[model samples]
Target: MSELSSPGGEMRLDKWLWAARFFKTRQLAIEAINGGKVQVDGQRAKPSRSIRPGSRLEIHKGSLSWTIEVLAINKQRRPATEAAGLYVEDEASREKRQEIARERRELGGQPQEGRPSKRDRRMIQRFTGRNEPSD
Candidate 1:
């Protein structure tokens, strides 16, 4: 069996999160753990906490959350497809996340695509009563 799928292996929570693609970097995972955005078995966990297969994790990031059970341990970060095999997210969590995403899309308040054009900037300046020397 691959080391990643070894039944009794243990790995640091932060390293696992990074390898599982939950966070872009181990530092981010550490920060989230310290900030109380990550929990193990419904209790706050430290970045260095050792986790094994079957450990339940609760992670909250912005408007999305995940409740998942660890399925494997990977020491190195992997592609998203492979990373996904490390954990199994709860069905309610998945549905809630999708519903929130759909609501955000339907709300129709997308941010401005990019920096405003010169004319657009001028209009904004005028509307906000903040005029400056024209370029």
Candidate 2:
């Protein structure tokens, strides 16, 4: 319960995202919003958008994505534990992330062992049916 939320029980999307520990800074949250990485109720959201409790957000960060329901709004950034209390990740989202992680692990830790040689690259391209015509 950080001193957040406007009189209407809503807070700026960027500020809420920051206070919730999603992005490291308000600037990053703003950038993400503008970059279409964040959506509210399945629609693209702006940093200035106001969000309230029970609002659903879909956030995509790199290879990880989250669908969360806002449980509370905090204006001030807090410790991880407290920040976590502000929202609950959707069950399906949680399970999907876990499955993806498990698959990555089973795929042998690092997918790329090292840079492949020219011949190796060609072989890989051919195997994948991406053979290109050589000049």
Candidate 3:
């Protein structure tokens, strides 16, 4: 049964994020919270902030941002699919993420070509061995 919709359940922001799979570790979630990468109900929140069911969350990571509503709270981390069920991503958020991904793909994946730097050259020389005589 889903724990979402329970009237009195509450969870810590960092714990929920870790259990929901938004972060690989609680420390990362805390860092993100402290860095202003996450907000609750349109306001910045601390890692220890309490989040109940239906709370709105805004999360920014790199070029992607997500607006999601809390659906459930699970203290123990679960499989990806189960974790996915813990929140509902807004339609606009999903569309925006998709559009960004499409643009990134269309822009081409290759980086600009440039000559190797001195450090790179030294590493290559070390790898290839400067002492090796050419045939």
Q: What lDDT score belongs to each candidate, Candidate 1 first?
A: 0.90, 0.88, 0.89
Off by over 4 Å in 1: 1-3, 110-120, 125-135
User: Ten-residue segment with the worst summed lDDT in candidate 2?
Assistant: 1-10
> Runs in model 3 with CA error above 4 Å?
1-8, 110-135
Candidate number of the best TM-score: 1
Candidate 1 vs candidate 3: which has greater lDDT?
1
Off by over 4 Å in 2: 1-8, 108-135
Q: After superposition, how far is residue 107 of candidate 1 from its true place, in Å?
A: 1.8
Q: Clash pairs of candidate 1?
A: none
Better of 1 and 2 by lDDT: 1
Error of 2 at 112 (Å): 6.2
lDDT of 1 by residue, 1-135 (tens): 255555568999999999999999899999999999999998999999999999999999988999999988887887888888889999999999999999998998977798998999889999989898456
Model 3 residue 30 CA deviation (Å) reads 0.5
Candidate 2: tens digits of C-alpha lDDT, residues 3-44? 553323789999999988999999999999999999999999
Q: Alpha-carbon error at 39 in model 2, in Å? A: 0.5
